[model samples]
Target: MLPTLDARLTAAAELVLPGKPVADIGCDHGKLTAVLAASGKYPRVIGADLRPGPLAKAEQTLEHAGCKDRVELRLGDGLSVLSAGEVGTIVLAGVSAQTTWEIIEQAPWVSQVGGPRLVMVPATRHSELRRWLWEHGFALAADRPVQAAGRWYAVMAAEYTGEVRIPTFTECLFGRTAEWPEGAGYAAWQKAKLPRFRLGVPDGTELAEEIDKLLDGSPSQTR
Candidate 1:
């Protein structure tokens, strides 16, 4: 039996297109990569991590799962080990939005012709990541939340479409998360953050009210 992946990892995998090579960046244990390979959904899954310790752990997990042949383990900085169009899908989870940006920025090949799809789960700064994607010629395809590890995480899928689009204020704040159950929880969670948000940022009070109303059965206020 394949090792079960945590909710966040599972959500990330669901965003990837099947039968394509996948690169799981910062793949801590390779569990998700292994699962992706074992499912026969992808022809190859690359588990890339900067640290040797975690990559080694992933190696053991893949070996035990008997997917070592299908999953390639690499130790290098984000996306540095990958070439243009090497993998049509890439997964970035358990990292900050800034880190995700840094990884992608350092590797411009991802946005080139036939570039890979980005499936990311930022632990924080979902709004920042979303805004970055819009400004960088990538279009947001999916934005949903997953309840995992005693918290909620936003998982997103984007493609390098070469057309830039701006998201509304609410969409940046909470993403399309209001579209589902975990999104409701995500809305509540962001609403709770309003009280502690430092001044000089966007108006938390106004944003909070909007979120509250949205959660109270109002239509999605997206643009």
Candidate 2:
């Protein structure tokens, strides 16, 4: 029997288009790569990792699943190993927003003409990543908050549209949940965390005000 995908990986898989080539960065055990290969939705799947040990593990997992032929395991950091237009979509999950932002900033080719789509799930600070995407010529195509392993995660799918638009404070924090109903839970989750976030920051009053307005059923006023 094949290994099952967790809710998070399932969300990532659903974002990929059929027949498109995909690169799975930080593919720890190659589970996502193997699943993508088996689905026959992607023509090819590249499983990349910075360490050889994880690449070896990915190889083992792929071989065990009899999907070694469909997935090409590569050992490299970030997107350095991939060439321009090598794949039409890239997945970066289980990483911090800061790290994901750095990877995207370094790999400018991913935003060039006919660049690959970006499918990311930041383990923390999702607002930073969303704001960065808007400023970097990418458009948010889809965003969903999925409940996995008793935790909430934000799944963001974006395309390089070469159009720049600054995201408002509300969109940065809650995402465009008003447009994508799937993110309502995520918005509420973020709303609940605002108190804790306010405790640590010196200028937490702004966050408190936002939360207060939200609780009072008023639209968030941009800061």
Candidate 3:
């Protein structure tokens, strides 16, 4: 593992196919990219961000990991610095789901075969992002939640195959509840988060009820 990669990177790494090239967007400190390179998963890892400061820091991280040979740092907004067919996969973490989806929408190169695939962990607007992906062409490849430093986060992987239809408004908000780490633990977890999300989203009225209704409708969970 790269020195700076956290548990989220670890989970994302597990889902990535080995020997592919990857573009790490918003690669703060280049930690995740470094880890992917060191793990010998992606042949080349590109650490990209808009600011020179983060790129500089990422350069240092790659150097520290001695995976610098396999890593390249690019300074640009989203995937702008990368050319078509340059990267095999794209990883965007710690950004809003809206930005994540928008970046994908803007980058025509990503739709190419053997081009950039995307894995994103949006900081917020997750519901919107989920809806966007399904409406577009991507389908959920993996979904798992991890607690890091006392905060729970969902790690989502998606691939754009074709017209991914959205089933309902609730499904968009909750995602594939059939696949939501089915378990009693997850249920308890959601119960705890409801009040918070309710309090957080302005006019979270229908949103909260939908959550409760979704939970009740879900099948039995695991231990």
Candidate 4:
């Protein structure tokens, strides 16, 4: 049996395409990379971060898990540690949207691959991050929230599509597609979130409009 992953790590795992290489940028504990490599979810994984402490921890974890050969722990800024075509999918999690966007901005090759994927979990300023990604030619593939520690957190998966398609404000805020088609499972998944949004949400404004659009599928309010 494998060690359990937290909600954010699980969300990142779901975004990674099977059979492809993956890199976890800012991979703090290296837990996510170790789990993915040990599970055979990907053929290769590079766990990278700017600091060495976390990288060392990740290396130890991967070694203990007997997946050291499959997982590489690198010390550098995002994407700088990996060469061209090193990994098909990249995850930038456990960081602020500002830092994450800066890394994405620096890595131009992100737009070169056929179907390269990016999984992001921004701790703050996510609206700015989404808008920046859309402006930079990424397509919003999947956007949803996961409950963790009595709080709901959003996850976004995007790909380099080389086109500028602005997501509606609602899509940008909550997510871009209500046609989620993941069926009752997803709706049930989202429904569980309604109460929290109702309870803690601030005065009626852009966020509320966007949330409404996410629920009702209205482009006018969302756009």
Candidate 5:
């Protein structure tokens, strides 16, 4: 039997394009990797982690799922485990936006044209991550709002478009998720954080006000 992925991982998995290989980075328990391998949609599957302990756990997951031969487990930091173009889609989850950006930045090839698609579920700072991706020559191709474990999360799928531009604050916060089914809940969750956020940043007050208008049912014009 294949491992059942949680709501977040299930959304991440759905964003992966078919036909090419996929890699699950920071695959803590390797449940997602095993599930992908068992699906047999992709020709190859890889599960990589920066730590030995997690990689070991992933190995066991593949074994128990009876898909050990279909998935390759690698031990390395971020994208270092695979060469550029080795996979068509890359999944990064269970990490903060800062850490996710650090990993992607270290792998310059991911920003190249025709690079693999990125499906990321940042544990925090979704706005910061969206803005970083836009300014760094990537575009938010797709996004979905997933409510799991009583909290809302955004699954961002981005691709290297080489169109480096600064996104508006609303665009950063909402990305392309406003039209999604669970977008309202995700927006509400983000809005609830503004007060605390306002306490820390210099422009937090203005930023909060701007987002407030959008969250008030005013349609956002984000790209």
Candidate 6:
């Protein structure tokens, strides 16, 4: 039997481009890793975790899937387990936005020309992650909204563009997902969190008003 992925992981996997090696960073049970390897799309598949327990579970998952020899499991922190250009796609799932940013930030090579693609599913702070990526020279190539276990999540695929720009609050919140089938639910979920996000910012009032107009079906001034 092959490993199976939930709706969230399935969306992440779909965003992966073919023809190059792929790495599942923080690969907990390696279900996604096993699936990727079984697909035979990429030349190589790697599963890396920071802890021994998760990596062990990942090993078991790969073994059961009969693709154990197809995946390389590494024990290391973040992207340190692999060298630059080793993989063309890097997956970071089931982690907080802050944690994902920290991992990508540490691996500057992913921002260089011809860097690997990034497929991320941030457990929290999705808007913040989009903004961070935009300001750091990474561009959101695409995004898909998916619901799993009764919660809506966005799976974003980004690539290094080396063009840093300030994104509007609305753009940060939406991130090319406004047209997806589950986009409305994800947007509403993000809208509900704006109140808390506004509490600590200096331009809270303006930002909140702008985001409100955009989310309320008003024509957005900024894309």
Per-residue lDDT of candidate 1, residues 1-223 (tens digit) = 4789888888888999987889999999888888998989888889999999999999899889998888888999999989887888999988999999999999978876568999999988888898899888987778878888788788999889988877765678777787767776777776676445533445457655665555466436352
Better model by lDDT: candidate 1 vs candidate 3 = 1
Which candidate do you rate higher for lDDT, 1 or 6? Answer: 6
Worst 10 residues of 5 by lDDT: 214-223
Regarding TM-score, does 1 or 6 come out ahead?
6
lDDT of 4 by residue, 11-108 (tens): 77888888889998888877888888987878888899899998888887787778888887889978899776778889988888889888887877
Query: Which candidate, 1 or 4, would have the higher TM-score against the true structure?
Result: 1
Writing each residue's lDDT as its tens digit, candidate 5 over 1-223 gives 6788889999999999999999999999899999999998999999999899988988998999999999989899889998988999999999999999999999999999899999999988888999999999998878888988887888999999999997888888778887787887777777677666655655557766675565566546465
- TM-scores of the candidates in the order shown: 0.88, 0.90, 0.81, 0.78, 0.92, 0.92
- Decoy 5 TM-score against native: 0.92
User: Model 6: C-alpha RMSD to truth?
Assistant: 2.1
**lDDT, candidate 3, 57-175, per-residue tens:** 98888889889889888888988878887766778899887788788878876765455567778776655787887788777777666666766556778877776685554555455
Q: lDDT by residue for model 2 over 1-223, one digit each (tens)?
A: 3568888889898988678799999999888888998888888899999999989988988888888998888888999979988898999999999999899989888887568888898998888898998898988777777889888888889888899988765668866544555566666777787666666655557656665566667445231
Model 1, CA-based lDDT: 0.83
* Model 6 quality (TM-score): 0.92
Q: Model 4, residue 144: what's the lDDT?
A: 55
Q: What is the C-alpha RMSD of each candidate to the true structure, in Å?
A: 2.9, 2.8, 3.9, 4.9, 2.1, 2.1
State how far residue 132 of model 3 sits from its true place (Å): 1.0
List, residue by residue over 11-109, the lDDT tens digit for candidate 6.
999999899999999999999999999999999999999999999999999999999999999999999998998999999999999999999989888
Runs of candidate 4 with Cα error greater than 4 angstroms are 113-115, 177-223
